[model samples]
Structure formats: structure tokens, C-alpha cells
Target: MGKASTVTSWLCCPCRCLFCGVLSCFLSVLACVLLTAGLVVLVLYLLFRPHIIHATAVSADLTNFTLTPRTWILRYNLSLALQLRNPNKRIAIHYHDVAAEAYYEGQRFAHADLPDFFQDTGESSPLNTAFLGHGSLVGGVAAAGFRREAAEGARFSIDVKLGAHMKLKLWVFRVPGPKPKIDCPLRLKRRNATAGAAGPPPEFRPTECRVWF
Candidate 1:
């Protein structure tokens, strides 16, 4: 019985050793694969040399803007011209989706979806957006502020923002990249935008947008 036990133990020992060897080889190969993948990523990053994108507010036209305090309604017809710039000379970018919004006093009042397009390396394109709808103000405070601004017909300040999902490409390889967020503060006032005024000569100075990923 002791000799039989000894033979069984020896056979089991070889099986255990074989498993350990296979596991060690697999782990070694996995480590090599991971290391290679990391190095490739690093090299690609260096090669692309991507830079920050810029979106500048080139111009704007505000034809009609009115607010009714009792009804909490805001009506605006505003058009904007924004220039989108890609500073990277080697990395092309594709914008899959983009949305533009207009805000007043920290509240979103209107929005529009822009068309999706691709930007070649170091390209610049002009994008136009229009907000021509009315929205209900949610709070009394916002309504009061709108009324106050309308009373004097002074310059109206609107916060415009753009959000998008984009990808970067080099040669035939494409990598999912960071989404860009662009924020621009617009100040527009017609020369005679008094109470109940309608249209024309609204000045929208060119403004630089703050951008982030």
C-alpha cells in the first residue's frame, strides 16, 4: 500500500508542475502584450501632437428679444457666426455630434443642433446657428431679471455654449478622443433697443470662446 501511494503522488506531482509551467508562460506572454500595447499608445500620442481647438464668435445678429414677466415667456431671434479652428497640423478630427445652447442668467433658454462634419488638419470652418424660439422661464427670479433688462433695452448678455463628441485620426487609424466644450459670452445691444423695440444695428463684438475637453 505504501508503494502504491508513492507512485500516485509522483504522478500527481508532474501534473501540478505542468499546470504551474503553463500558467507562468501565459502570464509572461500577457505581460509582454500589455507592455507592447502601452508603448504603442505612447508612440502614437507623441506622433499625433494634438493641440487645443478654438472656437471664436465671429459675429451675431439679434433681431427680436422680448420677455413677458407674467407669462414667464422669452422670445428671441438670434443668429450667430462662429469659427471653428483645428490647430493640430497632423491629426484630423471628426465631429460626430454637436449641439449649441443659449443661456440667460444661468438658465438654458434655447438650443439648436449643428450638423456633423469632419475637419482636416489645421483647418478652419465657419459654423452658423440660429435660436428663434420662445421658452418659459422656470423661476420668478429669472423672469424679474429679464424684465429689468427689457425695461432699459440695454445690452443683452447671452451665454452660448457648444458640446460635441469627436474622434482623432492619423493615417488609417482612428482613436476616440475627448469631447470639446466651448463657452462664449455674447453681449448684444441695438442702437435703439428701447422698450418694445424691434430690430437692427445690434452690435455683437467678436468674442473669444473658452474651450475645454
Candidate 2:
């Protein structure tokens, strides 16, 4: 009985050692792979030095904003000039798609699609977008408030929202990622001092947008 038990223990000992050896080898290989991947990511980040794209609403024209309180019908013509800047010195930007919307009192009234283009490193470019024509305002309360403000012949405040999809180019390599939304709150009105003046139309002061990635 003693010899039989000794033989069984000998058999189990070798099997246990073999299983531990294989597991150790696999864990070692996995650790090495993970370390290598982390190093590669670090190197790529240092090489590209990518940065956020800055967008600013430089000017706005809202002279034709009109809203009917009875029917809640709105007729509007709004135009804006945006300044896009690539702040990265080592990377360029390739904008693939851009969309803009104008909102009054939290209600979206107009939208426009902009042409895709490329921006060089440390370059700034202006993009002009216009929202024309009109439809009924979705919210009655918002329309009434907007009408009252327009009648006051003072400033009308609205939000211009921009969304875009872009890629960063470093030399011949391209890195694609999601971009943050831009919100620019702007106030437009006839220069009360020049309201009745026989001269050019009034322009909204430049507005810096809020953005985060």
C-alpha cells in the first residue's frame, strides 16, 4: 500500500510542474506584448504632437430675422464668417465634414453644410456659411420672445453650433479621431447709434466659441 501511494504522488507532481511552467511562459509573453504596445503609443504621440482645432465666429449678419407671433411663422436670413485655426505646429488638419446650426432660445431654426477642405499647420482660414429661408417656429413661447426682442430694435441673441469630422496629418501618416462640438453665443442688432444711418448693415461683434474634446 505504501509503494502504490508513492507512485501515484510521483505521477501528479510532474503534471503540476508542467502546467505551472506553461502558464508562466504565457504570462511572460503577454506582459512583453503589452509593454511594447505602450511604448509604440508613446512614440507616436511625441512624433505627431496633435492639438485641438480652434473655431471662432468672427462676424454675423442677422438683418432679416422676422417672426410672426400669430402663426409662429419665421422668416430669417442669417450669415456668419467663421475662422478656423490649426494650432499645431507639427500636424495639419484635413476637415472631411462640417455642419452648422442656428438656434434661438434653444430652438434650432436653420442648418447648413460647409465644404470640406484642408488646413496647413499653424494656419487660419475663414469659412462663410449662410442660413436662408424659413419655416414655422417649433415653440410658440420662443417665437413670442424673439418677436418682442426684434420689435424692441435692440440686440437678438442666438447660438451658433458647429460640428465637424476631421483627420490629423503628420507627414504621410493620417490619424483620425472624433472632434468636439463648438458653441458660439452671438448677439446681433442694428447699431442703435446707427440704426437709421444710411450706411452699411450692422455686424455682430466677434464671438469666441466654447469647445472641448
Candidate 3:
């Protein structure tokens, strides 16, 4: 009877050890699963998240358009006032650089900045120099690509002040939360604009302006 009892105790010890090992492994797996699930939930929330409606392109107008000779040899200064209407509840619109492009006779002639009346919040960043034209004064005719003399019968093409390849980036954030990036493209046209003598605006209009959701 003594030998039988010792054998029974040994068997029970091994069984308990095996059960403990299995329990530890199960708990570890459970923790890993919970961590993975949390990550997945966070990703899904970010992907489908809706952002605050800030500034939008309500209407764009160009006024006080003027051109004058620049001190630089053959260059001319092109200055124009840009007025943007934002129906969204935001106070100001942020542009990387907003400016106007002047196309004459189907060819790009000069680029100018949107009026500096629009203020930028960040000082470290360059003032939203919308066009190739620098702030304060923008040299027009003498720009690198165009000649000093205006084309005899050039038609004007007006586009938004951003650079040719540059686009607008809308930042979405609930302060203290991770900020997400949304890219919005602009659609600008010369409105109520008249052409020189007998010219119709060129056919190179943007197909559609992109808006973020």
C-alpha cells in the first residue's frame, strides 16, 4: 500500500505541471490576441474617420489686376488682388503657396501671388508665395520663360496661385489626437474674364476639383 500511494503522488505531480504549462501558454496567446485586436480597431477608426469641415472654395475672384514695368531690364510687375469666399466655419484658409498663373495665347506667360491680405499662422514657413512672383512685387513679362514684349494677341488663362506641380494639403486633427493628412486639389478659372480682341479661353480647364471627405 505504501508503494502504491507514492506512485499515485508522482503521477499527480506531473499532471499538475503539465496543466500549469498549458495554462501559461493559453494566457500568453490571449494577451497577444487582445493586443492585435486593439491595433486593428485603432486602424479601422482612422481609416473611416470623418474630419471637421473647415475652409472650402466658395468663390474666387481676381481684382485690382495691374501690370507695370519692373526695374529688372525687360521684366514687368504683375499684381492682382485675390478674394476667396469660404463658407465653412473656419476663420482662415491655409495655403502652402497660393498664386495666380497667367497664360497668354495658350502659352504660360507669368505667375503672380495672391494678395498678401491673407495672413499665415506660421512664421518659420515662407509666406504663402502663391506664384513664382515673389511677395510685395511680382515681375511679369521679364520672367525667365516669357519675352519682355507682350504677345500681339495673347489670351489670358488664369489658374489658382499654387505652383504648377504643387497641391493643397488639408490637415485633419482633433487636437491631442494624431493628425491625418488629406490632399485637396483646387480648380481655378478666369471668371467673367475677357480675352484680347477675338479669343475664346483655351480648352485646358481642370476636369474636376478634388475634395476630401
TM per candidate comes to 0.76, 0.78, 0.28
- Candidate rank order under lDDT: 1, 2, 3
Q: Write the per-residue lDDT of candidate 3 for residues 1-213, one digit (tens) a residue.
A: 999999999989989999999999999999999999999989855754523322223333332123343533322223232222333222223443344455432434455544433322221222222333322233443332233222422223333323321222234422222221222233233322355424543333222223233
Residue 163 in model 3: lDDT: 32
Give the TM-score comparing model 2 with the true structure, all chains together: 0.78
Steric clashes per prediction? 0, 0, 6
lDDT of 1 by residue, 78-176 (tens): 889999999998989999789999999899999999999999999998989999989887888887777677666656778999999988888888889
Q: How well is each residue in 3-111 modelled by candidate 2, as lDDT tens digits?
A: 9999999999999999999999999999999999999999977977767778898887765777765888778777889898889898888887788999988888899
Residue 156 lDDT, candidate 2, scale 0-100 = 86
What lDDT is reached at residue 65 by model 2?
A: 74
2 or 3, which is superior by lDDT? 2
Clashing pairs in 2: none
- Candidates, ranked, TM-score: 2, 1, 3
